[model samples]
Target chain A: MEENIKFLRSGILAPIKKWGTHWSLWPVHLVTACCGAELAHAFASGYDGERIGALNYGIARQTNLIIVEGAITRKMARVLRITWEQMPDPKFVIIMGTCGLNGGVFWNSYHLVKPFEVVPVNYFIPGCPSTPEALLRGIRQLQNEIRTGEPRSSIEFEKVDLGKGKMMPVTPKSPKKISLAPSIVVNVPRKADEETKKLADEISKLGLATTVTGKNRIALRVEKDELVDAAKKLQNFGFDHVKNVNVIDVPNEDKFIVEYHLGSYSKRELMPVVLNLFTELPRSEPKLKSLAKIFPSADYMEREMHDFFGVVFEGNEWMGRKFLLAPDTPEYPLKKDFKLEEEKYLR
Target chain B: MEALVISHQKQIGDKMLEGLISGLFKIFTSNMMNIPLIEPLVDYLMQIPLVNLLVALILWRPFFAVIILPGLVGLLIYLLWIVYWERKLTARVQWRVGPIEVARPIRGAIQALADGIRYFFQEAIIHREAHKIYYIQLPILAFIPILLPLLFIPAGNVVGIKTPYGIQLIVAFIALIPLFIVAMGWASHSRFAYIGSLREAFMYFAYEIPFIIAVVAMIYVYGSGDPYVAVEKQNIPGAVLNPLAFIVYIIAMIMATSRLPFEIPEADQEIAFGPFVEYSGILFGLVMTLLYEKLYLMALLFVILFLGGWEGFYVGILGDFCAPLVLFIKTVVVISVLVIVRSVYARYRLDQAIRLGWTSYLTLSIAALILGMFVGVLV
Candidate 1:
């Protein structure tokens, strides 16, 4: 008799429970690394996140859930914290992939940070680059929480006490001088190979000064006005994509070296070419023309460089303030003479 | 003669009571009889005049069909099936197998269940800046309006309710969704929420007219305000009879539900989840359901307007219940088609989406209306 009653109640209530469980789980649009590509795939065709109610929203403030993809660098930490605090309460966090849990391959890197330390996470999905399936699972977990008003897990943190120890105030030490050669040097032939020389000659024929730094490597010192034309020439030469846009700060020289690393996704013959464009600016009021207008992909990289080096992009008036880095950090820490420890004490 | 009549009536009553008692006893003793003892207890208690009257009043045909039964079983099953289909479809397109690990044998049908269990144990994060009451109330409130359109949606002959102006009623209810979305955004009290709310408001205007116009064109051609009658008239299927209206309706459906090419308000890369940015746990879940609810309502409209609702085979069982089977099949087909489109296309830019809705879709729908009228006259 009792068993029959249980069955009857379940028959009546099960549908209600299912209905409540099906409609929730709003995923935040926070992409931390390459796993974001897979995240997009999960929400995109075939695996449409919409069917499960994991609609991807643009701003963190209005979104109640966050899917922290792979890596959350120290630079993204502040944004994560602010975004979490900005959202209305009763929000859920799904740390997608192993990188978010323990930093993955970048675990020991200085830049990577654990996402849970900054936000109260609800779900931890295990995957290198989590497939869309994993993401949907995480969302379903969130929905279950809604049906049964119970907390998924407790937020645990270890608080260390230093009150028992004696402390002494001490002057900060200067930053150690690490050899820059490791980063600067390239394993290039001292003399240009025949193919590189021919390319250099062809580049010069375009009425531009060309310097062959190494085999298959060419540098063009173009005027600010001619940078766009130089980029077009390189594109015609089959250097199809921009690999990296780097800005080198030289405070004493009152100038910054802005370089665009151009390479090719097509053409085997032009495979070895690494086109470099360098332009200098006055150090006192450093500003350079934005290349973002020419290459749409350069937009984010330029913003990143501006955040680290404080070199403003003149034509890119809309370049928002510090992207990856915190706004409170004193001076561009990457500058040669800047000391991070001293600045911390001084502030 | 009067005494004989009274005795006969009393004997009949006694026999009926005996039959009921025997039936109750059989329910408990027989192996095939799965009815529980509690059911008899409840039935005995329900014999009270007041409670029985209340039960009878609320269990009216429309309420039972729309809010009680479909809201429970039909909605849940549909959500689960649609979710599974979406994942499998997207996985095929993106070269992956989605959620197979959770339920390996069944291809992760229980994946959603596992997720729900996990969510039950998770913490809810409520922010300080939020308007405490309104923020909490909006998601719950939004659901009322979201579910309202279901009443007018005919599932074959098994409609929840029959209203004269069914199309107008459904459109009006669906139109209230954006307002609640704005309420959710505003109650969150955050910058992104503010921006997202504004976007929702803007998008609401952009798609509203075109969507309604398409519906109007169909109503004009069908010459009926009732969805059930409108669908019945489409003996050749609305899509075949009026291909132009079909295309316009499909595009308008995409815009209304904020699907790809028109997912502007909730542009994940630009504004985040928009109005739902602050929702978490169950609340977030409610916000998520809002989209599906919208989709389900839109799917119903599509079935009635183009696909021919509840117009297919009947196996002749359960009378009215079986009547809705055709409509359910049609809705499922429509949803599958909508979900499949996600794999074939990327989201259009906001400007492009608005332009398409206003210029191209609007013009096409108007042209369809004229054509429909011309055909009506010729026929």
Candidate 2:
């Protein structure tokens, strides 16, 4: 079997085999991230990867190539490995976008794994979302490599030296610390408009302090203990669903500000309204009353917050399981204390 | 007495061998494909020893029909042509050049061959859960029902086996195709394959009745199950004579082959090729072509019933061979037109397809039966 395959692979019949393999480079459709949109663009009418014989086929068994689209969160990394392992022999992997290379904008993300760690990569296409042309060019390069047995990169990196013979520093210099997180105010005081006045008047009946944060944005803060009762009042006030769950870490205050952005889907006039319910939890305990049952839509958002903030939603059964992150992912990656290895080039 | 019996047996064996040899000569001369274009070379080749037998077997009407045109050779060429043409046509409609990079000058005409070779060389994986023997056997086994129809499909003066109930036999064979597909899905033992197999069974029930009724309607119009008699009766093409049947046949054709709007069983988006989810390498390749082969057979039957099979302007040079060529060309054209369906429509939901198959197609097929009867009486 070995001898026959060798004969087909690199012996007398290698050219024929190469020709076939080149034209039949079907990539398994395993969209890992946002780059999949651009990958779709590459395969769609505008670019048409089929013209070059790289059809985006479904199922790992039928495909011979894997085009890792972009960022692979830690959870997706496991899936990526399994899919790669399932693919038949003589398979190729092409990781597209800077996210897969060094995580790009998510460079120090707590829940991300480089695709190379999951599977052996044959090529890397760099861009946040690489252009369709770049993607096709990558396939063309792969075809050439198959025919010639030469591992050629689609791009060439030219070296640039700016120091002009100056000696290297003995110790690597540290960048000035500049955090990019926006300064968030959970309760910003503002004058109420007619709509806000109506909303505030109704919310004030609940006996909770309400503030007009912005147009269609209301901030209602309550003690952690009263969160359930305040949410029940708001639920009765016609906030149909939870739009978002947010947590702001304040290490100096030794507190975690947990907020649920609620919105109305049923009441048409209240469609534009987004009511933020804010509560402060002690950093040590970091636990809150679960609002999953209060608003059915909050169940998943609550789980995601549970994954990111390590905030235990008391009644949510999924609090312990990893929903959005890999089981092995670092705890509370979004917290202020969870510093990613300090960015050497950060300014 | 024993010595006399042994001598008599030897004599009988010798005579039997002689009769077979003489029979071959008679068969060759009597039914050879009389190609006027290649008459001189044919005559010259007939005078040779071993080569003459080959020429004789190839030119013999039944053998020619079964092994040459409208059979193995025709199927092979159609398989290659359809794959490339489908991609090219879909790309054109989608506003893109397709398959041109491989063999750039010929516009990647050999793209399928390249893929076939790659599939041949790649490993055929049998996952742990798969029923190994059945998984290995099913792809090859599925071809039996598909190829069995060719024996009954008459082309001009050449036919493999001319049964009076030819159309019915072909339909019976066509129905067997879905059974093998169902078995394949069961053998695969994968979740997607299991879902795919169940969908295949549902689709089989959905489309088979309308498709059978459509064919039966055509038979009623012709007043015979024999394709040759149907072809002879068509002074007017069946498509024009009984248009309701023609329309039903076209719709049933799409549904039967699982073309777009009806590609539910092997929906890549939903079930990842359904029954073929676990197929890899050449095994995948074999199963992939199953639908195309089914489409070819259906088109052959469709042409005989509606599109005027072998009724084109006859080529004098090709003689009896011309009919099969005409039929083959018509079937190819029919299938080429089907490529538009892929780009024009998205797949329908299972419930939607079932509703259509049960309600619309079934009602139309019944209407076609009524029309065929009225047209038959008038003619």
Candidate 3:
């Protein structure tokens, strides 16, 4: 009698829970591409999904459901993983459309990455662009799942063992080939563009050494002694933001080329202007001046380049590897002879 | 006695033949004259081509005067008035100028037209993934069926098509809309499209039965399927005679057009315009027009069913056009009432909409039918 009574109670409470879940399934809006426009409409005046209690909020810290629209490229993969990690537990991911499922029309494209591999998904809604009604149905299904606490179904794939009973074959690393030629070759000329030449003449009057490479391309080879003052001069001339902080390793030349690509969003003209600053260091102790004292945004980019290229920044305390790339990746992948396939195969 | 009987029979036969010939003649003449009137105009305008096209645009001057101009211009003006009225009425019901922005001058009358123009020039982008051809075609195709319903809709005594079973014919043609909507979804070739199409199909099933039943109840009450006679029978207006049917029919009409609370297929935020996700530019313009066209048809039906067709208290100075003007005014009022519901309430969920259609609305319609039968017995 007690068992039957308990069973009856469970059944009665089940539907109540189901209805509550159905009424409150909030979907997170993570806009990626053009499909974001249609997604916006699903919540707008004509359809009005807000009546069902699905609201859009920006921060991932609060939202529980992630609606991944489509295309997650390699660069975006890092962002996706980091975002997923940032969200609190009990978060659900709803992969919308065929593209979100397996990259859809963009399948086999180099830039596309599978979202399912990055985050555990609750529901996969099938459609090139699923209708609002269909999306509602998917939401309803998700609500049903939450109430029931059903384990989601997984895709089936067979795995094969390549090495059958025998020890895995190992390959030896090929001998390293070295060239005696200097890798750090600088092309310096006195002639420059009108604006750069005027700026160069002013710098020359200040008794500063500057090399003009090409028209408008002024390479200021600032030593550690005068680095700060030179950066200040460039900053005054409207080279505000740092675009790319590059670090090149030149073992043959016994030095490292630390280049700071600077630019500014001009308020007067509403345009971006780029300027470059380069300085070389000994390869044995490759330490260069830090630009963190000048452009703040350059601080992160310089630290990132330092981590990958193994270049050192003198007086920069935050030189430790940040989370941009995986720590386990062997050597800098951007280097001339760093074969990614060989590294993976060796591993 | 034989000669007298033969003469009477001949008189009856002559009158019957004359009526048939005259009906056919009117149909042909009306249809044929429209071509000549438009052709000479088209040719004379085409001769000057570029300059004439720029200045005396065919769609602009006379054609606008005839078909589109009056309805569109009137609709634009009416939309504003209706929006204001709706806001005021709903605000009174909810107790809130509804619109206080332009209330200081024109009393917020030009608000809807301002919004319409804003939407007209708004940038509509077609996404890369959408099926390009069908995504563009559906909105334009939707207008055809919407306009077709207008042909059979009668306003007072002024009707585009006068038929024995005009109301039945209009209802039949309007029913074909869901199939076209489904076609639209399938053509767009999006998941949202498929889902929206399915929702539309489901909605059709839910509302079509009760809507047809309500119409049948009205036909039974009036003893004629002809809209003109039906309107004549409702001298006191159908709403007063059978309030139950009126309520049920209104609900069904709302469901049919996917109006507020039942607008499941095109839920904006959830499916992102659903089947029309890929549509942009002029195609989206058509889709927007399609909704107004639907509202126009329903408003016409509402005027015919509840407000007594073109029956107004006064025949204004417009004379024969007065009836049509009255009918137009009543239809516009109905449309305003219908559209104002949008700003006030949000949409209902799919399951809830279905339940409403099946249980509440279905029961209401059946009860209305029963009430009509009781009234029939008493009369």
Candidate 4:
């Protein structure tokens, strides 16, 4: 394949092909992350990527470039791969973010995946959210690479001794560290009204503990087995929608704290209130009764939680399938022990 | 006497074939291009055996009409010029310098050329799911309609084929271009392509009726469909005679060519070039330009019906070349003025364009037709 590509580029037609490819570097508009906003800026009237002959094309197949903007989560990795696979050859990829290099602000995020792992990159534009000008510079570099048949950086850097030039302060130590034993508290002490106390009293019978977390917020803690019963009673109490499902891995405690944030759209008065129905399960057997039937909106969120933490929402059907993550992605990535590769600073 | 008659008939048949070949030369050379500057050169070239035939084929009025001026060469130049102009004009309007880096001296005029070359070399991927035959054939096949109309559209005395219904035939052939686009989407076998094809079909219905009616109104006012007759009769251009039909035609033209305000079917942001979602490389380029070519064809017809076709001061030196040049310039100017919508107006939704086409354009075209009938009676 390498030889074939070289052969095609070795004749009088080489310059023509390169020139054509450079001017028509239409990037497929796949908005994967926050950097996509800057990409829009680059293409929009402010920067006008068209002035550089890099229009933001809409489809994958017709486009010759992919500006993999910012971070790729576990879920978006598969999409990135599929989109890359679909584009025609002589294609180029420009990863436009510090996150793409080593995760930037999401350096240790459970869901973040490196974009370079998904697609062969032609250029890396480094910034937290790379500026539209920086993005255009990256495109200019790609154009230069196409024209000259050699990959070259847009700017040159000369070495500067930071310590010698100025009176530099000693490097500050990172103040925060991952908690070895998190208290995992969902329910804190708070006062409750008679109506709330009555609701809590009714809910506490089906659970181990109850607390009014805040205004319009209630928390019920239950054993893994009693989760369904509590969800059913909450539905009966007019909380008809499950806002989200989340799993917190407490490796030190040898357990997983699974929480379902429930709300109501069908019942008017209950609309502002969110009830957190949570349960503790042994890490060895992190299976919980599914409340999917009681709250239909919980189904998709349950699948996502299952994907991240491997906590089985027992009655839900898609327990093992990778709904949000790529099939080849490491399993149960949100588990406390799961580690992304450490970032390497440039010398 | 029968034997003598048979020999005489054979001699006449031989003379007819000879006459036809020699007929090619008469049209090629007589009152040939009169550019005094190039007259000696043309005459010198006319003496060469094969080069003369080539020159004759090139300068031969009808042959030149289809292949050079308003046909292949004209189409090529228009494609190059319009693509650049559309981007540059849109950029200027949007407050940016458009495509100046490539051949900066000419203001990136060759940007389209470079893109074309790139597409030529780029891998034309035929996905496994596509219906291989039709997927490959449709883009090439679409050219038939786009090119077929060029034969009948007259530029003054020059026409590939003279027919009374030249205007109608051009419209008919131009309408056929959309069916192939729908076929392409079907052949692509993708979800977006399917949606795009449906939109293209909806758009076809939305515009084609009013487009025909607008043309019909013009034909009624002109009293004939022959372009020459329309041109000859237009002491006042058709736009002046039937202004409502002119409005209807321009709007329908936008919808037909899938320009900005009515560019719903191939809304690049919404459906990713619609029916052309799956096309890549050269196939993508070809499908992309299909609309521009269709626009060129309709603009040619638009000029003939409204802008006085080829009614410009005759460049006596160039002889027959003068009319096609005038018509080409008129078509280009109309298109240049028309493309301002790209930067000025946002694309309409499929339903909005349809409603506009079906209700407002239809009513105006019908009104134009009624007015045309009254005017026809007066004439």
Q: In terms of lDDT, which candidate is strongest?
A: 2
* Lowest lDDT 10-residue stretch of candidate 3 chain A: A338-347
Q: Rank the candidates by TM-score, best first.
A: 4, 2, 1, 3
lDDT of 1 at A221: 81
Work out the TM-score per prediction: 0.57, 0.86, 0.45, 0.86
- Candidate 2 error regions (>4 Å): A164-246, A258-306, A311-323, A342-347, B1-30
lDDT of 1 by residue, A1-347 (tens): 57854553366655444443346455666786777898888776668776554556665544557778878877788888887776654467788888888878865444566888888888888779877887777776667665565546433558976563445456555565533432332223357889988988887887878788887888778766677788787767677777788877665455667888877779897787887777766666667777777666677888878876777776675565767665645556566655534223441
Off by over 4 Å in 4: A1-7, A108-110, A160-187, A191-281, A284-305, A310-323, A339-347, B1-27
Q: What tens-digit string does per-residue lDDT give for candidate 1 at B149-240?
A: 77877664445668879988888898899899999999989777788788788778777886787777778778777987787787788787
Q: Candidates' DockQ values?
A: 0.11, 0.63, 0.02, 0.58
- Ten-residue region with minimum lDDT total, candidate 1 chain A: A180-189
lDDT of candidate model 4 versus the reference: 0.85
Top candidate when judged by TM-score against the true structure: 4
lDDT per residue for candidate 4 within B203-252, as digits (tens), equals 99988998898899899998999898999988898898989989998988
Model 3 CA lDDT for position B21: 58
**What TM-score does prediction 1 earn?**
0.57
**lDDT score at residue A109, model 2, on the 0-100 scale:** 81
Tens digits of per-residue lDDT for model 4, A1-347: 88777877787677767778888898885676799999888877788888777776668887789888777888788889999988888899999889888888888676777787778899999997999999999989998888787998887889977786565455433443457885678788698676777766766775447888777778878777777776777777788888988888888788888889988888776787788888889999888888898889999999998888888888899987999676777888778777655544332
Cα lDDT tens digits for candidate 3, B1-379: 9999999999999999878755654443343212243556645754663544432332332223235423455555555566456545554554332333322376545444433432333234454555667666666666666666666665543455668787788788778778877887787777887898888888888999998888877777777788888787876788887789999888877787777778888886677666555454345546645655566666677778777987886544343445556777778767766765665678898888888889988998898888877764543
Give one digit per residue, the lDDT tens place, for model 2 in B248-365: 8888788888898899999998999999999999999999999999999999999999988889978787777789999999999999998679889999988898898899889999
* lDDT of candidates 1 onward, in order: 0.70, 0.88, 0.64, 0.85
